[model samples]
Target: MRLNNKTKAGYFNFLGTLVIMLFIFGVGAFLLEYFVYDYFGWAQWLFLIIPIGCITLFYARGRQIFEYDSDGEALNFKNRNVVLFLDKHLSDEFPKYKLLKYDVVNIIILKRLYVSISSKKSHNITLRYDISYLTKKELNDLKFSLSKVIKNNKERKREPSS
Candidate 1:
């Protein structure tokens, strides 16, 4: 199965633009109120908080695009921030048979997928991907896909190689 949240990238970009516009509007309102009224009103606090709150929320939830491909013999994963230069791009690919286990952490503001794969050096390497932008249905599908791979790996190990 190949899964990607590419469609949501545009939505996130739109939201970012909206947030910036709101911040600009808020600043204009703040300046107007200060210059015309000569005193800060109670509503002024909301203008200040609006942009800060939006920034905090987006930062906590992350702004990365996550793609997972279980096609062919290897599982591929790619995660990169919407703002390309803001963060380094991350990509990982490994054979499906080496996948030992996987876990999805879903907290109120944080969502992440952790995959553990057996490495050639007799150690397990864990890869993490931000899944905050994924919808609940998408998240469930991802979990199901990972579980299927892990089950197959376990079953393959149980069978003796002739």
Candidate 2:
């Protein structure tokens, strides 16, 4: 899915916040050096490194796409390989098909986002992704595609036995 400017803005916002915090701490350290003591100067530099490292790591990880086939199997993200196994079964009260019922539920829009998918077997899967670099349209499309995949898998599993 293509990422939009909104998502990019979100990432920038996070990075911006981190930079601002580091700057503030650096300023405080400078003041301390002038008025209090120079012993804590290293702390300011160390604090600044953390935010920079985080920003670099975020960019390096790149984007992630999740795709599930009609047979209730998920496509391996890294290798684009098909995984022909089920990790765990949902509980009795909630069936596996329940995951297909929702259009979208519990979506948090931010740098780090969390989504919840409830299965019919009384179990739920929580998907966590970074959306700070995606646009609103891209995010919506991704969600829709995921829902459709889940629905298709559910239907496939319900076919009558021969």
Candidate 3:
């Protein structure tokens, strides 16, 4: 599925982050004054710089595009800086790696989350990453392609290994 991060979601994410940061600071400042009995009025506001700066960086980083291709069996991530392939089916081969793919196989669709593929060896959450906003066509195509992979895998018989 070819998709880029949604500009609207990034903006909303920035605002939401700003609001949460403000709330956290407000609470921290209030607690400091009440317990410490120090009347450091307005001085506590300096900490606001931390959240503003961090959110600004995060929002800027979110602009990079991410793409996925089930037919090609690869996902372009890290702001398209790196390519992740989908062919390495675990089948419980590497327990450590499966631990991570537990969350890597999900994508967003129509503002809803869906797991395009998952492992029987891992217990992953349905809700996952927020990047990769997709078109209806792309989403449908990815779903269809993933379903075929899942069906084929399920139909294959297991063999005893040495």
Candidate 4:
């Protein structure tokens, strides 16, 4: 199984550009109203407030891209911020038998995936990924895939090798 949010990359890029453009335009308009028109009103404050709010929302919500692949002998996952050059990427690949447990949290607007895996050097390692852009069906599919891996791992541990 292979799943990724690559299809939404263009949408996020366009939205980021639009929000920035809006902020610039709003500031420009506010300056024009203040200096050129000598206007002092509540509406003028909205020019600054609306754009700033938009920028804040965009920063909070639409920043990460996630990818998951569960083919062959190992599971692969990748996560990175929308700004390619600025933020570090999270990438992991571990064998199926190493998987311990997994959880998915879906709140009002935030969605995240947490996976626990056994490590040779440590007791366990936990990985986190943002799944905010995934639809409900896609999220279900991801959960199902992780659950299958964990279940198989447990069963394998129970069976004795002959």
Residue 120 of model 2, lDDT score? 56
Model 3, range 33-87, lDDT digits (tens) per residue?
Answer: 7568667666655555565665455443332233444334443322321112311
Candidate 4 C-alpha error for residue 83, in Å: 2.9
Q: TM-score of model 3 relative to the true fold?
A: 0.32
Give each model a TM-score.
0.88, 0.38, 0.32, 0.88
Return the candidate ranking by lDDT, descending.
1, 4, 2, 3
**Most lDDT-accurate candidate:** 1
Candidate 4 versus the native: TM-score? 0.88
Residue 24 of model 3 has an lDDT of: 79
Question: What would the TM-score be for candidate 2 when compared with the true structure?
Answer: 0.38
All candidates' lDDT scores?
Answer: 0.86, 0.46, 0.43, 0.85
Deviation (Å) of 90 in candidate 4: 1.9
Per-residue lDDT tens digits for candidate 4, residues 1-162, read 999888888888888789899999999999999888857776888888999999887766534678899999999998877768746888899998898999888777777788999889979988888788888888889999989998888888899999
Ranking by TM-score: 1, 4, 2, 3
Alpha carbon lDDT at 130, candidate 3: 30
Q: Please say which candidate is ahead in lDDT: 2 or 3.
A: 2
Worst 10 residues of 2 by lDDT: 75-84
Clashing pairs in 4: none
